[model samples]
Target: MSVIAVNDGTFVSELEGKGVTLVEFGAVWCPPCKVLLPILETLSEEYAEGLRVLKVDCDESPVTASRYGIMSMPTVIVFKNGEPLEKLVGLRPKSAYTNVLGKINAEAARL
Candidate 1:
């Protein structure tokens, strides 16, 4: 499944649901952000059962971006139980994300 695109008005509500969420704060003009899109898409499908991947156009959702302290484009914030769990800036290998997901899953299992 494709990553859901969210604006400031819909951002919080989208993340209000249960489970893990990876939200990318980026803009259309960012090159690295464009490159990260496919990676996120693949992840959204691979973790469809346990994860929700979302994208926020920084230009369009400045409020939500600032709320999360997004200082740069292509910042990915991982949320657990509707709270910020981790933040990964810039583009990263798929394994980087999988590693975090693994940890989240392990923690979830422990709980």
Candidate 2:
């Protein structure tokens, strides 16, 4: 699956009130942000059962970006129960995301 586009309207209810949310804040102009799209998509597909992966374009959704203090481009925030659990800045390997998903899955299993 592809990354879901999120905005101020849906950010809170969809991310905070729901289950795990992996939100990526980025701008279309950023090269690194462009590069991370595929990885986000892959991760979204891999964890579709338990995780909600979305993208908030900094240009399109400034309110959501500022709410999270997104100073840099391509900031990845992982949220559980509406609060942030992890923030990954810059470009990272696919394994970096899978590791986080694995951890969340383990925790979910325990719960």
The candidate that wins on lDDT is 1
lDDT of 1 by residue, 7-104 (tens): 99988888986579999999999999999999999999998868999999999988999999999889999998689998999899999999999999
State the C-alpha lDDT per candidate: 0.91, 0.86
Task: Locate the minimum summed-lDDT window of 10 residues in model 1.
Answer: 10-19
- Candidate 1 residues lying further than 4 Å off, grouped into runs, are none
Taking every candidate in turn, the Cα RMSD to the unseen true structure, in Å, is 0.8, 1.4
**Candidate 2 structure quality by residue, lDDT tens digits, 1-111:** 568887878777667676888999998899999999999888878777678888898888889999899999899999988889889998899999889878987988998
CA shift at 34, candidate 1, in angstroms?
Answer: 0.5
| Overall local distance difference test of candidate 2 | 0.86
TM-score of each: 0.96, 0.90
